[model samples]
Target: MSRKSETSGDRRPAQADALTLTGRQAARVAKRRRVMMLGLRGIPNVQGGVEKHVEMLSSRLTGHGWEVEVVGRRRYLPVSGPHLWNGVRVSPLWAPRMMALEAIIHTFLGICFAAMRRPDVLHIHAVGPALLVPLARLMRLNVVVTHHGYDYDRQKWGAFAKKMLRTGERMGMRLAHGRIAISREIAETMGERYRVPVAFVPNGVAVSHCDVETGVLGEFGLTRRRYILLAARLVPEKRQIDLIKAYAKLGNTGFNLVLAGGAEFESAYEDEVRALASRVPGVVLTGFQTGDRLAELFANAALFVLPSSHEGMPIALLEAMAHGLPVLASDIVANRQLDLPAGDYFPLGDIDALASAISEKTATSLDEQEVLAQTERVESAYSWSSVALKTLDVYRAVTK
Candidate 1:
């Protein structure tokens, strides 16, 4: 099919013609380019990576003339009903609070809502939710599915859940009208495995001026630039235990280790993380921070470490680099794709190597020139504006 024919009903007119249209006419055009996004917990200070991605991408799509609505689980959302945030409409839908069933149930309900509303496109994020793509297609709704990561590879799921996640990946990649992968590695793997084209639309980072406030530092009893920061949920794949053990290996480093996230659901893993963290001195657990507190944590850390065994273009790592902090990450495919310096990556799940890297990184302060260069590199490559435009192209491709 020709591109113009596929996008005839949804694409905006040429710039010259758009400039000549009346305000009401422009509103009508924007309404025609509607997209409903699902597959995340909630937004507007939600802690998970997918939630942050949807919040950033959906909010920015409004600027480019796409009417955006993010459907999230009612249990996780801060508000009770439909609301407007940053010019995008957010609808909180009903979903059971069970850990295993919440995503698929919420997505099924969101797809049904989309079918009735008949938006120009229904954009689903993550493979777990993408399991319902076939259903959306059965309802004759234009569908776009974004494979955030290989959820089957995450250590949190059981064998049966892992198998189901693999099936979700298969159905989402093969059945959706449009496919997007957040990492180049994921896109390539899906294309090769499913024999389908997948757009590589990476997660983005917004670099903001550093917040010099010390109130949060005081609250946490931390010193500026004297704490090693890891800002991810207390999940098994994130390998918080590895970081804690590595920090214990470094005796008298004078740097506190701060874990700035908590789990959304109750799990034995979270309990284990807390027990292990309490045994080690100089380890602080600040549960699920956001807004200024998270910014403060990012801005004042001595070094940022992401020892995750699984990821889909980690937004926390990107945000840390955007803050000009030196980073150490696991050498997984997703983290390696960031192309950080060779010394910045240690082998995945190697506690000794992670310890050595953390010690070496904290021994010296980052040079002013090096900080500026790192900040510029991340800011240029991972701007949210670029992400929004690329995603809009995907929506246009599948619409009409």
Candidate 2:
């Protein structure tokens, strides 16, 4: 008897079969893929750019079906033990509270934990934590280092610390399986310096939906559209002092100058900022705001200013634009990468220039069209979802 002829029902199309196989392969990779992130303070209400970056990136990575665990410093994390945060696991590890010793010690401990857990990829954030890249490599772990910025350029670190950071940059750039930089300038600099291909995955901002709540306004003695806001950690490189001096130069402009962040560790610099703010009229220091409070500050501000001398792509600047607030940042390489109009930037560390810009910006408000355009621009360009996808590509590349 002749065998039944194969029909469409018996054999699938070649393209269809390939598509099915690809889908299965993707599912298998997602199921088995795991990444452990370290080198940030923690997530969920943590301050600092790196912390916020890790928080947003790790949460979105879970949506791609990759298992994500962030190793957090126990001193900074609000909760104890391992817990799930936004579909990503947070493993709190202990570290000394000292500013200089905390990151390295915490990273060393995290590396040991990573060794035991043996995540498919050990993703380390920032140069300070990147110091342990060699140790992570020694354990035969697949390490991916993200250069947030040149930490050695910051004014806070001492000579030895700066040397260590430089060494970390060297080792992380040369030794890691994959390298990522948060800004084009950083990626280009590291790539040219090390002669390695570095991925440029920028920091992102989430557009806030929170209403302009007046509770936080009243609490901080701020009025809607009547205050200039600077929200960043109390650090030397952030140049809060420059902004404060500039705001002081504005005299009585009928606008309050609000500093909306606090330091991770108590330092003389924090004390100095507080003292300076105390001396200036119409200047308010709101210590370390998160959640709706920060959103309100952004939503209601007349203008936002970032006078930082160093950054890896400032997330606060993006958040300010996302809130449709007119922004004035220092003309630094990192801030310039955002491609804001030349008029929006002032000479770095120039108090007179910053004061003039802030005066001009706050005197007039952004029209409805201007506000919408700014918000749309930020949302389109710097999206956390987009960052997650790009970062996933890097992880996959290194894994392969």
Candidate 3:
């Protein structure tokens, strides 16, 4: 009788232990559904491709039953911005506002903060911040690195900075549990060089839902479909000077060439661009614009040109395409992947070719059918919902 009683007591404890173990397992599953995003400066009206990407992806992830926390830089985010935007938690970490050191320093601090949060996946964006992937991995965090572009190839980086970027690429490829390349071209390039399989997840564009504010157009003295638009950061690799020169060559084209991007950092290139723009007759520098202002600009443009020397799937070009605007992009490998018609692609650095193409495109009437087809293609292939699902797949793969 004593043996039977003892056995019953043992079974009771065993049953309790089983229930406790089940609860712990369930908690782990819950934790695995949470993510920590890093590397982008900040979000919500920020003038950056990566920030836009993070904002869209994070907002969409939550709807699919994933909890997301984005680490933002205090300097970049507005003072009035809330701790939460669209259900994604925002944690701002203080960092110096210097150009070269900001990303690395902020990413280091972000990784430390993420470690404490114990998110299932630590998703790092851009190669600059991927420098600390090894460190994050060492902390036993599941790391997923997204390669935005070949930063080392940018004209602004010095030799040491270039080397650091290359090193970061190496470390990120080797250390991270998974990798995402924003374009097929980027994915193929990285895979060939590093011998690591990467998931190709291109950047997405949202169809503008805002009404075209004609008042904003009047504020800039612009007419509907009578202006050429190039909206991107006023940086060297974007080659705004090249566009300025091309526009200057096409004097009296009747279409005002508008450069609608803000200076990224104080530099000789920006000074040179402004100097060139000053010399040009028809070129307009509208600085940085967003929201309805930017949408109206895109909606009513005669033609959109992206003559960047380099790109990782240019978001500005995608935005123009999303708006059903006729796009003329340089024949850079990334841009070529868009499969624009032969007429739409001008040879890189060919000022005469760009000027001529601009003149020709402006004079010719846009094929509404072609524009509709392009918009359909862009929306179908590069929807944020699709990007979010693919990114979530990467996160789940890494965590599992």
lDDT of 2 by residue, 1-400 (tens): 1244333355566534544567777567546689999998899888888989988998899888889999999978889899998899999999998989999999999999999999999999998888889999999999999999999999999999999999999999999999999999899999999999999999999966676564889987777899999999899999899999999998898999999998878899999999998999998998899998888888888999999999888999999999888999999999999999998999999999999999889778889999999898899999999999999999999988
lDDT string for model 1 (1-400, tens) is: 5766645676555744665789899777656688899898878888798999998898888888788898888877779899988998889999997889989998999998999989888988999998889999999999999999999999989999998899989999999999999999999999999999999999999754545674888998999899999999989999999999999999878999999999988999999999999999999999998887789889989999999999999999999999999999999999999998899999998999999999899998789999999999999999999999998888878864
Better of 2 and 3 by lDDT: 2
Top TM-score model? 1
Off by over 4 Å in 2: 1-30, 212-214
Question: lDDT of each model, Cα atoms only?
Answer: 0.90, 0.90, 0.87
Looking at model 3, report the run of 10 residues with the lowest lDDT sum: 12-21
Where does model 1 exceed 4 Å of error? Answer: 1-31, 208-214
Sorted on TM-score, best first, the list reads 1, 2, 3
Clashing pairs in 2: none
Full-model lDDT, candidate 1: 0.90
Question: Candidate 1: lDDT of 363?
Answer: 92
